[model samples]
Target: MRNRKNIAVKILAVLAFLVFLIINSRSISNPFRTGISGAASLPLKGLNGAMRAVKKIIPFASLREENRLLRERIDLLNRRIEESGTLSAENRRLKDILGFKNAIPFSSIPAEVIGRDPSNWSNSLIINKGSAHGINDNRAVISMKGLVGRTLEVGRTSSKILLITDPNSKAGVIIQRNRQGGILVGRPDGSCKMIYIALDSDVAPGDRVITAGFGSVFPKGILIGEVAAVGKEPGRLYKYAIVRPAQDMTKLEEVLCIR
Candidate 1:
């Protein structure tokens, strides 16, 4: 049985060779026939298909890498855009502050807010400008929004501002809406309390408050803040009111020094 099986395999191989030889002979005699070329090119076509599969996988990996790189570039661009926006806003605010200083009759200096009091509730800031820059004690410090504080202590190159919200700081203010007068005093919690406001005064919430320039500390017409709330104690002689400071002290970055 084994001998017969071996003979059968040899016969099959010999038959296939004869078939190939016949096909080649016909194509050689008839040039229009494609049998020889088709048979000869089969191995190359199979190899090309395998290569195509490999090439397809390569592109997929390349596309994934490319997408990752593109995402990284987008992230970098977004960060740059955010920084540019912040810079533009800062430039505008600084320009406004400069314009305000230019319009005033007093000599002015520019300063950058460098630090704040460790006590968060304390209304004070340290500036980069001081005696060296002509900033002196009691010089008014202001921002685009309004009065920030007065220079409390002066160093060679830096100064500390006693913010209007400091408990010891006070400003004589008038109600812009009705010309009522009051003493604006800072509370420990960063808001101003209006003292000596008449009980029957026509003051209301949202009234604009401005420095009266009576004490000669702050300039007239400098915006201080808007009325936040109003209330009266049962036996008090005056109505107590809270004023929201125009300058957002927590966000202060730059200021003008008025001499």
Candidate 2:
């Protein structure tokens, strides 16, 4: 194949040189010889044009292949960029969790929110740490902001949590300014209410609520929420206050597991 291509190139070069000489001839006096050369050059010129067309085609296919490879490389780089963004976000979240863990004085296990209960989405969640990592049922769960929930079920490396906003969940809390204590219970709508507050109590909205340290389940002074509203009925014996949780339960990502 190499020898054939070399021969074809040499033949074209010779024909092109013959054409040049025939067209620019000044000393040729024979009309027969000049006309014969012109006729021979006609076929050679067409052949040269065909060779140029083929040469153009060869480079075009190569260029297309190079363009295809470049496009693939760009796509790979784009995918890597997306993955880098995701990892950066994860690193930031992990740093926040670490800072929160360091700030707390008590012993706790840091766990990542892995999943949630689909059947009762508002009530429960799953964490990455479980019985194997010293996490078990009824252990208190909290976030950097405040109390999240308590451990419900435990596995070897995973566990489910009962959110504080769940209607069935309950905690004992107290007003920070005053010693007024009450039962913080969850509502169906995912908010908590402090019950058994006295009507004449000096309680107001925005009062900070924290764990009373009286219960065996949750320890001393973990923040629960802030008072959103105080409710009073004319005939009611006790005034109840609506408590807004410190933690955003809907966005649970990392939490502290206190035994």
Candidate 3:
């Protein structure tokens, strides 16, 4: 009896498998078999869904890489633009200096500033052109704005400029307002103190000051600075005032040596 039961169960299992195969074969052959095809391809549908997910991730990865490359390109372009602008500005400044050099009545030698005094109060610089370039002591140096200084010492290939703000330096200057004349003397700090003006002189703020050409060091009509402030202390014979320098010594780069 047990052997007969086991043979019946095996026959049932074989029949069930045969029915499944027949249904799938019919679905494959007939286009109208919708429900049967869906049931048969459940596992394949899951694999298709996984493939679609991978396809979506591909676009996202590609987009991220494109963004990174674009950022790098933008950075490169910005650097190039900055370099071009700097070159253009430098060329303009050099052109202006060349034009000024040509217009000057006195012959001049061009010099590049090589070094600067470490102390802010020193107001002096070293130039690459010196005695070899025909630069001599007491020769004036100038820039686009106006007079800078005079060559204090010269070497074979280098020279030192004694800035107008040196304490030991003095220049004869006149006020452009009323032609009131005074001497501009440097203080320990980097400012010139105007002295020898009459107590009743009419010098006011914002008046332009220029080299008077009396001392014969700096040429006449060279701009020095503007009158910043004026004051009269008790028992003082002359009015004293401070003058701001026209050229900024901190930004000195190129200067002309007046022969």
Q: Give the alpha carbon lDDT tens digit for every residue of 49-106 in model 2.
A: 5765685566556555556757767756655665577569778888888888888877
Give candidate 1's error at residue 186 in angstroms. Answer: 0.5
Which pairs of residues collide in model 2?
none
| Global fold similarity of model 3 (TM-score) | 0.70
Better of 1 and 3 by TM-score: 3
* Per-model lDDT: 0.78, 0.79, 0.78
Off by over 4 Å in 1: 1-83
RMSD list, candidates in order = 35.1, 34.7, 36.2
Give the TM-score comparing model 1 with the true structure, all chains together.
Answer: 0.68
Off by over 4 Å in 3: 1-70
* Weakest 10 consecutive residues of candidate 1 by summed lDDT: 30-39
Candidate with top TM-score is 3
- Model 2, stretches more than 4 Å misplaced? 1-86, 120-122, 233-235
TM-score of each: 0.68, 0.65, 0.70
TM-score of 2: 0.65
Per-residue CA lDDT of model 1 for 30-105, tens digit only, reads 3322233323334544554576568546645555555675786775665566557756976888778778878877
Candidate 2, overall lDDT? 0.79
Instruction: State how far residue 210 of model 2 sits from its true place (Å).
Output: 0.7
Scored by lDDT, the top model is 2
lDDT, candidate 3, 201-240, per-residue tens: 9998899999898865688888888989998868879998
